[model samples]
Target: MTGNRFVTQALGEYTLAGLANCSAEIVKTARPVNLNLFSIKWPVTALVSIAHRISGVLLFLAMPLLLYLFELSLSSEAGFRRAGAMLASPMPRLVGWLLAVALLYHLIAGCRHLLMDMGFGETWRGGKAGARTVIAISVLGAILAGILLW
Candidate 1:
């Protein structure tokens, strides 16, 4: 009674003090850490994956801005010219180039999704082939964009 002043319910594993000690041990032994690439150079497939995610994020975030510009353009003629002048700027042109690339990536990835939906790229080999296709298409789109923009 002198040492054990408190007890949990009848079916319990630990008192509050016991739980605190257990948690401290767990924290010391099981601290979370990031999976840093210690010695490996980045792989092409990983780059492609990161690019895909970036393109997706860019498209999602740009959608709102693009929609707002559209709304502003429709509000009045001055609004239309303002939006037009913004697009005509060097910075906006660069952003447009980025958006175009993202759109191309999204389109190619969406086509891959459609193919998978249709049961085309199901197996590991098929998935690899589809990834190859994405790489090819993404490169092709870049070439096309370069030609168009230049």
Candidate 2:
């Protein structure tokens, strides 16, 4: 009923639960828990999530450089040759390779996140394994990209 105190209190508690980053135990006991994201004791799942965020940011930052290169390569024969020469340099090659690695990592991590949303890797063990798998695939893809780039 609109005048029910218990219903209002329950709704408030649920809203607070959704807002806080506390664990289930903290929620059940209604106690505040101090969490440090930079702690060394973070699990693989946390590491994977952090890496995913980092890679996404890296990709965002690289977009401008990629677009500039694309424009240079498409403008004219001289512009295309200049773009090729720039890419042939060591520093540009390294940066391109790193961006490629970031893309691969982001893509694989995205797939993992999608699977997680579909109810896969929802358990503790599954989450850990999925993190490891994502890391492994990213490393392999980066190495392969490096080889191909050079």
Candidate 3:
């Protein structure tokens, strides 16, 4: 076996030495590292992209709670009433509205991404416009969801 070579019984063969060398070389390169996120002025398109990811994560995290409430609502008549009452409270209503807004934003951003995949909004100008449009539509959807929920 060579100094840079390693063998794994399950994986057959692998080499970490090359990866280590490559990372070391990368570290030696002079690159500007901005650790302060707040100091950077992010573009609208970048902000929208970040928000899209955040909304997706929020939706994923809320899924279990949503499914539990749904199951409770469908379990029995009393369970249905209890679930309704629980959702009727201020905090639950606020959470539900927030989830609704996140869902709406995610859906809108997803549509924008699909459009981009289809060759639309590939340019800088187009991407910025699409991001603005997504924000506008999401805001409108949030207002509508709030009205319906409240």
Backbone collision count in every prediction?
A: 0, 0, 0
lDDT of 3 by residue, 28-107 (tens): 66322432445444667768878989989999999999999999999999989999898678899999899999988999
CA shift of 76, model 2, Å: 2.2
Off by over 4 Å in 1: 1-47
> Model 2 off-target regions past 4 Å?
1-34
Q: Mark the 10 consecutive residues where model 3 has the least summed lDDT.
A: 1-10
Residue 69 error for model 3, in Å? 1.0
**What TM-score does structure 3 among the candidates reach?**
0.76
Inter-residue clash pairs, candidate 3:
none
Instruction: Rank candidates, lDDT, best first.
Output: 2, 3, 1
Q: Which number leads on TM-score?
A: 3
Residue 29 lDDT in model 3? Answer: 68
Question: What digit string (tens of lDDT, one per residue) describes model 1 on residues 1-150?
Answer: 101211222113323334465677785775434333433344343445567788999899899888998999999999999987886667887787789889898788778767777988656566657778898888888778867765
Q: What is each predicted model's overall lDDT from 0 to 1?
A: 0.68, 0.78, 0.76
> Quick one: best lDDT, which candidate?
2
| Alpha carbon deviation, residue 147, candidate 1 (Å) | 3.7
